[model samples]
Target chain A: MANTETALKDVMSSIDGAIGVALVDYNSGMALGTLGGSAELDLNVAAAGNTDVVRAKVRAIELLNLKEAIEDILISLNTQYHLIRPLTGRSGKGLFLYLALDRSRANLAMARHQLKRIEAELEV
Target chain B: MKRTLRQFTGRRPPVLIDPELLAGPGLLDELSGLRARVPHLTGSLVATTDGLVVAHDTRGLEPSGVAALTAAALGVGARLAEATGQGEFRELLTRGELGYTATYAAGSFVVLTLLAGPDANIGRLHLEARRAGRRIAELSDAVLARQDRD
Candidate 1:
């Protein structure tokens, strides 16, 4: 059972081109744990703000009546890829794993695959 | 589409109907019933995914604010479920030192929020609230369809 802090450290250390990572509680719009953010990219704010993005997509899916679950929501920016993966574990409900990756060096497909693995290993 | 759904529903000089009017009382009944069934239930409310209040049985706390915040929490919770490969959102529960706040998806666009004292029975809460959430969804969905007809 990977704890929240170690699980986040694992994400940062193992994920290539990782700019930052955060474990966010969407229920309160707060980051339970965060690491590796730069001045330009505040993990706390990014994690908090992405809560809205996730919510918007959920609403969109419902409004459109598209009956499918989101695997992850990826925001591909000019120089960054912001990945939001909601944790599936029993203790992790109402929270998500947020990772900001540098587009130039990060492999999107591989990053997605790894995030999924890390999510399963995460206890909360 | 939403505006069109809010229409007049009765006889000549038809009365303007709040969409909730179709299901609000039923929703309220469900909320109150849950409170009565579960001891220490401080309050309960249902809201649209957009944060609009549908029905509530809360006290002291403002229903509108709670509704808005519930929408916000629902978003993240739903997304979190999606990310983790959970098929769909079922329910979310949070425990505070003083009490517990639980949310269950009523449908695609509605949620039921409940508050219980610290001493409240968590297991019973889930069993009861889950049932109430489903009924709320049915009630809300029926309202939505009714609005479309109006």
Candidate 2:
């Protein structure tokens, strides 16, 4: 199993146009680890805001009364792509991998594929 | 099309209830209306923050099991998101070989789950679902309040 930090670093380096990457806890809206964000982009605040998004979606699902599993959430912005992937493995429940990329240089399909790979190898 | 939550609740009594500071009744009609719009959307559900089933379409699936699974997934997803330092998780989508499953936020009180076949148009589905989820949150808040009044 890949250590969390090394696994994260590998993903960051492999993906082009990756502006930032983080491991976040949707439950508490906290970032356990982060890399590559600059002065204008604060990973902590982004983690909290995204937590709201996750919470809201889960609530809506309950109201509708559907039975399904969530894999990943992709937010396509004008110039960016925010990918929120919920870890499904037993060891990684309640955790997610968030990746931010510049649209111009990022390949969404490849990015998603790579993230899944990283998730498989990550050691929690 | 528009339907009132009163009309829906009158027709189908909710399966469960939990009181809290949240949205109200108008939200339910909006959820029903949303269900009406999506053709391939097999079902939808709302669960509390702790992952209890609040309400559901319940076409043929087990409501409690779904809620438990969603809650478990949410826990893992949240942890993975934090471990990587990417920030808070906004949503999660699982694309299985057979179908697709998605979870979205509905304020602080609930989570929305959408299950669709391979043919479902993801882009359009996401847009409509998000709108519907918000409407439900508002309705849930109202419903909780009405119960309080009684």
Candidate 3:
């Protein structure tokens, strides 16, 4: 199975317009690993902060009694597309992969598809 | 020898230096800071190499028990590393179905241990933990270095 470093490398190299990526644990709001961020976008801090976003969505699902699982969450900024996907694998519980893409250059659908594939092969 | 007999008496004070005494409150802060840096980490601990609790940020688990186990593991790991010509023991990591248990040698006298969720990224854990381990070793050893400033 691809480890965290290799998985992140694939995410950055294969994905178009990828700005930054992080694997985060929502429980304690830590970014286990981070890659590809500029001074304007510190991936570690940015991803850790998104723990709140993931937690809120999970809580909302529970409170609403919507038994459906979250496939992903998206936030579109002026120039960036932020993607958050909670891993669905048995071993990936409580972890999510965060990716930021350049809105102008990224094909959102392909980025999402690649992220999903990478997550599947990720063994932690 | 009198020194050898003193050991059998089992009354000698344990620990050369208290982790808290050597590092003080900053030790706790170090542990807390690590908890913040690493994601999905349940907790972290720093203990004497011989199985004494120093500073810990763990939850719902016995720090002393883990400390004791750390000593046991360290002994075996050190020997295994040496026997296999791996040089000095640096770190060890194991994964279970649900989580990870990682150990890093902080200094000659202490170790750092961490427990993280299953999805915890191993690469990130190593990066952060190695930094923490070096910091702890320096913090603790600085005290001894001051005394030995001959």
The per-model DockQ list reads 0.02, 0.03, 0.07
What's the best-to-worst order under lDDT? 3, 1, 2
Q: What range of 10 consecutive residues in model 1 chain B has the weakest lDDT sum?
A: B4-13
| Residue lDDT tens for model 2, A1-124 | 7877987798789988899988887754567788888897777767766766776787888888978666789999999999998877777887788899999999999999999988888878
Tens digits of per-residue lDDT, candidate 1, B1-150, equal: 122111111111133335366445677789889988876789998876667787889889999999889867777776677678775667789899999999887754677899988766565677678888778777766766666686
Candidate 2: residue B86 Cα off by (Å)? 27
Instruction: Give the TM-score of chain B in candidate 2.
Output: 0.72
lDDT of 3 by residue, B13-125 (tens): 23365655564787889899988877788989898776788889999999999989987787788778777888777888877889989999886567899999976656567
Q: Which candidate ranks first by TM-score, i.e. highest?
A: 3
What's chain A's TM-score in each predicted model?
0.94, 0.95, 0.97
- The candidate scoring highest on DockQ is 3
Q: Categorize the docking of model 1.
A: incorrect
